[model samples]
Target chain A: MMIPLADLVTILPELIVVSAACLLLVLDPITPSNKKDLLAWMSVATLGVCFVVTAGSMGDRVFAFSDLVVVDGYASFWKLLLYVVSAMTILLSIGYLKEERIDLAEFYGFVLLSLTGMMIMVSGADLLVIYLGIELMSISLYIMAGFKRFEAKSIESSAKYFILGAFSSGLLLYGISLIFGATGSTRLVEIAAAVDARGLDDSMILIALMLVIVGFGFKVAAVPFHMWTPDVYQGAPTSVTAFMAVASKAASFGAFLRVMLEGFGGMKPNWSGLILGVCILTLILGNLVAIVQTNVKRMLAYSSIAHAGYALIGLVVAGWVGTEAGVSAKGVSSMMLYLAVYSFMTLGAFSIVAILRRGGEEGEDLDDFTGLAKRHKGAAFLMLLFMVSLAGIPPTAGFIGKFYLFMAAVNAGLTWLAVVGLIFAAVSAFYYLRVVMVMYMREPSPDQEGETRLALSPTAFVVLALAAAGVILFGLYPWPLVSLTATAALP
Target chain B: MSVPVEFYMVLSGLVFIIGLVGVLVRKNLIIILLSIELMLNATNINFVAFSSHFGNLSGQVFVFFALTVAAAEVAVGLAIIIALYRHHASINVDDFRLLKW
Candidate 1:
């Protein structure tokens, strides 16, 4: 079969990323170890090119590969955000790998490869395509998570993530097969039409829906399926953790949102109730548990889980409004806005966690942050900004993201859900502020004195600056992002 | 005689349940990986059954993709397991608890 040029053009960004990754791997052998930064820069350049291409095609909606994939405003929106996130992650990793003494050029290659998966995921129009995309992404992540191969904790995290991730994919495949049996097609548009015509009473469809939710729930780190998150986040290389927390989560949610809104749109009444239960549980557990954690990474892990809960509110509202198109779009657009906001704050927060190397010891413990205001006022101020945003305080991106989601919930007549979310948001403030308190109010312990030093690398400084600017700029003026998401919402 | 679709569904469902139980209850890492394979094969079986029943090729095509993905997963899973084994001589899931269960 002859493939058309038009189909190839539709997937130009994916092709660019994949080929660049392959090129990087090929160039890795010839390039000396000290020059791995060259590979990193090359990867960043590749993302820059892909970014321009994706932005250029943002207005076009085209299906390619026999309708297996699509490129549209929605996919382009997520892809643009993902490119920025991945680029920042690569930039952050250059200094991190040197500091950690792990000089593997293939790390950048894997980032691009996994990014290729993510690009496919957000653009996937068929279930099989999405499944493949997820596998690609997860497989690369499993490898990246254990890049510090000698470290037992890192290896353990990789193994646990692998076992659980594969299990979840199996569950997802079973759900897909069942749904195929029910609907007779694996395409999202076809599935939506089938469910619409057949109605939602089929036991097979219901079971399939539950299985899909469970599958994606694990990917998104929702409650009950979030067991692997803290361990994985805490154990993986800090740069990898940041990427996973930001770009990977965005991609998973992108695919999840599409699969639900397009494949199972007709089953909104059914799924909204189940997702509501997950959301409340996630918020309660994530916020309360984060408050007690002493390690900052683990705390952020739980906090990421809590953020997932906030994002799920958008999904629940989207479903809760049932057949109402306008309200549902609000829900979807709010979800997009929340994720976009989340990428900035979470990436910024994790970058801080990544850079704070104090005299060869990682500043992972909350105690390491004591008297940060005195030691490095700039770092402390940035951390304060991120923590405040994370807690959803006024005049920060996090607050705006949550406000829009809550407004969406109220509009969908789920005012009680909004109230529950608000209560958790307030509860979340305790831990976020505790970080700020440690930075500002306390003095460094005598034992850690004189030996401690902050290694704020040049690239990390750039990332922090960009992330800070995004948090402040979007926080103060959200209309641009708001309108962007409005245009990108699914029809 | 051709097997009925219901029989295929029931058989695959039972296999899927058995595999899930193995993944959840088994302590050995290899057994868990094998269990995941079982779950994937169960899906493949269901897909083939439904494909023939629906008189369509998409489900069969998906089985091919699933098989390919399952193979890729094994490759990656075994590599990770090997890394885990190097860090600790044991392959038992209970033994590696440095990062809190």
Candidate 2:
């Protein structure tokens, strides 16, 4: 019944996050509605502390709690992303919730709780721990999605996300049980060792792998499993969409890598083919369908799915060829880099959408962005950077992210896959730059000419500015993030 | 007259298939939630079967966690349905179509 000291040390970041969430919940009752922003600010500060603690506890590669959790560079890398994404989402929400009259303390609390779940998910070494973490993150997200209680779209978003989320969880759980049956263990290392010892020709192992992929495919919004993404992204509050698109997706990818690389590393060739097939389908559908969408949020939703395809390339390469050093896995590091860059660009893009929401109307329609440069130059400029970067243009993080992913692919001798990804990247630029053209070239219409400019809250402005800075800064100087992810590549 | 482990697994697989079919085919929100629970319980049955077969405690241990998670999931599921019902005035999955492609 005794817990290990190593366990406590490893769980320190999670404890800090969850405890802060609980404190905010308790304090919410006494605090006035007008001052709910305090909870948001406080939550951001707590996440900041989590970032620092995770950074500080980075030296040893220790597996705690009987190796159910790992305190390694990979965990550290993901925890940092989770904290930054949650913090960015909170800042984005403060301006957003105020404009919409959704000034709730629980919103901040849930953000922290959900972030805590992601932290657990990336750190988890056991299948059971990973599944529980996913559930915790998913349930919080469903409630958060429905935060705009009276709105039908918001409620519907919550409903669809929950049902599908639960269904996927069931599939994932069944897969885990099957894997357990085949290997007689749920620990990832033991599973891998079992695979090594027994070999990969077992039909049960193959079925379990497919079930697990479907579960994660739904999470990452990959093509055959991306039915919920557009609706959820369009319907959920902009801030929540940003959270789901980046942090939740990153967590899913993180768990996916851990399971594939660690748990099923022995059968890399098997999962690699399946990942390659889905990656191709995801790229084509996400880009092609995205072009037809006029709604900006939904476009970005599909864009996120396409980005998942690009990251999947890294997964394949990492499995097939691996990283530069070959000692540490290169595949996950590139995927991590892509997700981190994506978090900034996508959130920056969504924060602009959040800024547009004033007087109760969501400014997500494509026409809503017409003549934005004329309306507000600074916001328009930031949005341009996000869009350009998202299109993988130079001098932005998005380009650097895609570059690392493709380079990893080429390094792994996946030049053919990289070529396919390049074609999709070119196709993606059309939709992304279409936003740019609308903002800069189009003129305001008769009625829209004198419409008042959307007010940007200080926090939201700061959020957008931070995201923009990260995009350009990382793009220009990618080595720091590159090295960090490399160190965190394997265990 | 002893039952083989394969029989239990077949039973669980049939139950799991029925539950999955219910989830995909049923129209009622509450029934869909129940179907999900059934799917999870089928997994629970598998876990215990494997645990006994493997003579390890982890599979049984996994069942407890899965059951607890399913309970929590249902609570959240029902809460969301209530919220949805408040707005749409119905609990049918087909009626909840505020979002589409």
Model 2 alpha-carbon miss at residue A372, Å: 0.8
State every prediction's TM-score relative to the real structure.
0.99, 0.98
Error of 1 at B50 (Å): 1.2
Interface RMSD of each: 0.6, 0.9
The 0-to-1 C-alpha lDDT of every candidate, in the order given, reads 0.92, 0.89
lDDT for each residue of candidate 1 in A161-186, tens digit (9 for 90 to 100): 89989999999999999999999999
Residue pairs with colliding backbones in model 1 are: none
Total backbone clashes of candidate 2, pairs 3 or more residues apart or in separate chains = 1
lDDT of 1 at B70: 91
Measured with C-alpha atoms, the lDDT of residue A240 in candidate 1 is: 93
What is the overall TM-score of model 1 with all chains considered together? 0.99
Worst 10 residues of 2 chain B by lDDT: B1-10
